[model samples]
Target: MFPNNLAFISSNQLHLVQSSLLSMLKGALHYTIPLTIITFCIGLVLALATALARISGIKILEWIARIYVSAIRGTPLLVQLFIIFYGLPSVHITIGSFPAAIIGFSLNVGAYASEIIRAAILSIPKGQWEAAYSIGMNYSQALRRIVLPQAVRVSVPPLSNTFISLVKDTSLASLILVADLFRKAQEIASTTYQFMLLYVEAAFLYWVICLILSIIQQKLEGRFDKYISK
Candidate 1:
């Protein structure tokens, strides 16, 4: 039989866990989720533009896109975030923590996702473009009407993966003083000295969020597959 005091300790621990979970969830709802959605939407636009530029055959655009992608891919995301949040203040370009996180994550996603988008665009047969031209479609028209639709189907899986990754990466924003999910956990743990429990709780929340996203990704893939098959 357990000691009577053991029950009281267990109850206290349970209360702590529940309260910590609530605080972390609030942080996630307020910052982590919103940041992910906003950054990813902006990143997708940047990715599409960069991908288009790379394939545009304009030397200047290609060079600019290439350098941007190279620079982003070569650096660590944490370093990028640091540069935006910490390093920039020295140059008199001080951005707030949330905005800095958004810019850093968006730029990182844009660079990596551009490559995925570019490959998807390239995977479409030359005949598709030729067929679009034969049907009186200009380059822009073909891209808008024929090519991009097909490329989107190809890119969905990888892009979904990228979004999932960005969800995890948002934890890094804690370092920049964004009160995201992990940051909330850190705050609670520091007070309670329950570092392991709080950190695991945070990880579990992340896993749950990612699991839901994975399900959504699968559904999206299935929907796109049906369109492709038809």
Candidate 2:
């Protein structure tokens, strides 16, 4: 009788795990993945603009970019999220949870990735710029046609790492009721009182997603390597 009861309990637990997995996956698919993609794309644009501004030889633009990067790097991401999601309403500017999360994440990414991009652009030799100029290329034309393309190859690996980190960072959205993967896990755990199991499962899902991203990153790096001189 005890063995039969054990089997019954095991079956119920398995069913619970399956249901929880499905629910969390739905959250990931519907929210987490989309959020990462959207925020990263927006962030890349911001990063490029900020990096260009810093290197543009204009004192005002450089100062603005410097201050922006410094502010973001000095603060914790959690604080940034709270300020956007919770504090914004005090100024009568209310943002919904998902959009707020996106704004916070994109700005954070922009600040950090701008440094990476700026470094990559600088790493290109001065001769490359001179060569472009010799070919009658203006500064903008040289950057667009020559410098930025090479910088992209150097920047890919670090940018991929940033993207992977962003995937995990999306869990922060749960704090603001974004109903992402971690939020789904919290919901399930609260009802079943299975916090350990649910949290582990949620972490496993995040690991899988990051693992896949790492593989893609490797593939991208390999593709970019073809252009590199031996």
Candidate 3:
């Protein structure tokens, strides 16, 4: 028999337990969701810009992009997060932890996603760009209407994976007291003294989030498969 005080075992405790879970979910939605979406979108834009710069005829732009990607990809994300979160405030930037986390994650993702975008763009037959230009589509027009559509198909799967990783990475925000899911779990576990129960529940919640994201990723892949074969 379990300890009578163990919150996990009692029928009447179910509502209380669920309320805690609901609180965790709300925290996740509030803190983690914004971090994920903002980082991914910002990263995507940076990737597009970097990819274009890398391929552009300008040598200075190409070199700048190369340096940025190399620096970002070479550094540990933990260090980058620390720099953004703690290091900048020392220099008077004074960014909030949540926004700093977003910037760090976004820049990190941008470095990796830039390579994916560049590779995707390069994988397209040069003839596609040429064809678009032959039809009087300017560089921007061709890139927007012709090249990017195809590149997006190639980019979606990896980008989805990046977002999944980003979701998991949001746990790092707990270090800064952002009150995300894991932080809430830690709070509950610390107070309730049911470390194993709370931790297992937290782990299960993380797994469920990943599973849901995986399902959506698969659907997105299927949707984009209409454009790219492999």
lDDT of the candidates, in the order given: 0.96, 0.95, 0.86
lDDT of 2 by residue, 111-138 (tens): 9999999999999999999999998999
The runs of at least 3 residues in candidate 2 whose Cα sits more than 4 Å from the true structure, single-residue gaps closed, are 1-9
lDDT of 1 by residue, 113-181 (tens): 999999999999999999999999999999999999999989999999999999999999999999999
Q: Mark the regions of model 3 whose C-alpha exceeds 4 Å error after superposition.
A: 1-19, 227-230
Clashes of each: 0, 0, 0
Task: Give Cα distance to truth, residue 89, candidate 3, Å.
Answer: 2.0
Candidate with maximal lDDT: 1
The TM-score of predicted model 2 comes to 0.94
TM-score ranking, high to low:
1, 2, 3
- Better lDDT candidate (1, 3): 1
TM-score of each: 0.95, 0.94, 0.88
What TM-score would candidate 3 get against the native?
0.88
Q: All predictions: root-mean-square deviation over Cα?
A: 2.3, 2.8, 3.1
Cα lDDT over the full model 3: 0.86
